[model samples]
Target: MSIQVGDRLPEVVLKRIHEGIESVDTRALFDGRKAVLFAVPGAFTPTCSEKHLPGFVEHFQQFRDKGIEVACMAVNDPFVMQAWAKSQHVPEGMMMLSDGNGDFTRALGLELDASAYGMGLRSKRFALYAEDGVVKQLHVEAPGEYKVSSAEYLLESL
Candidate 1:
């Protein structure tokens, strides 16, 4: 089932490109803190690269000012995520996390099979606002839709 508001985020370790790898225990990252976790289908895709991730990057400071740590996740490997972040010039406040094996996505029940688009298994575009590891709000976009999970929407929810 799709994760819902009030659900405790699943504990998982996701890889990141920064040499100091982030072996995140979801509870450790979210429990005792406010965070905005957003997911995309894959790294470097046109819509995701040009729009989704950039939206977070652009408004990262606003999120921080609101006491929200922002994280972006995709199904790509760490290397790809790192490269994509670098290319996109992702600012320091935003973390690019990799769910390369799709374990975290599966756990959230947000995995999307895009083989028809030649993308294999990926994450559906969604965003969650969590405080103390429990979700406070969740926004999920319909396939090919970008309205709900946008930074503006998330910020409004916060």
Candidate 2:
């Protein structure tokens, strides 16, 4: 089953373009802070590029104002995540995490198989709120649908 409210996030290493593809530990990122980690199946796909990530980019300050740090996760490499951040005009302080090998995705039980579409292992579209390492709220989208995971919806929920 997927990670639920009250579950402590599994420890994993994710990559980001901080001075050139730094590896970050999940515990260090989430522990002792309020954070929202939202995942997309793949970077630059239509829905994810046009709407999902942009919503977060547009609302990044709002989330920060509430004392919650935001991070966007995808199954792409750190390079792609970096490029996407640039393309989206993502502001600083919002993390663009690269799952790279889907290890973290599988640990959370949120892995998506897209072999038929030529993409292999990926993450399902989802967003989760956590406080000090434990999940407080999670909104995972139904396949081929989008709603609860949007930044606007998550802001309203908070």
Residues 48-101 of candidate 1 have per-residue lDDT tens digits of 988999899989999999989999999998889889998999998688888988
Worst 10 residues of 1 by lDDT: 17-26
Q: Against the unseen true structure, what C-alpha lDDT does each candidate score?
A: 0.89, 0.96
lDDT per residue for candidate 2 within 65-111, as digits (tens), equals 99999999999999999999999999999999999999999999999
Off by over 4 Å in 2: none
Top candidate on lDDT is 2
Cα error, residue 124 of model 2, in Å, equals 0.3
Compute each candidate's TM-score over C-alphas: 0.95, 0.99
Report clashes for each candidate as comma-separated counts: 0, 0
| Residue 67 displacement in candidate 2 (angstroms) | 0.4
- Candidate 1 residues lying further than 4 Å off, grouped into runs, are 20-22
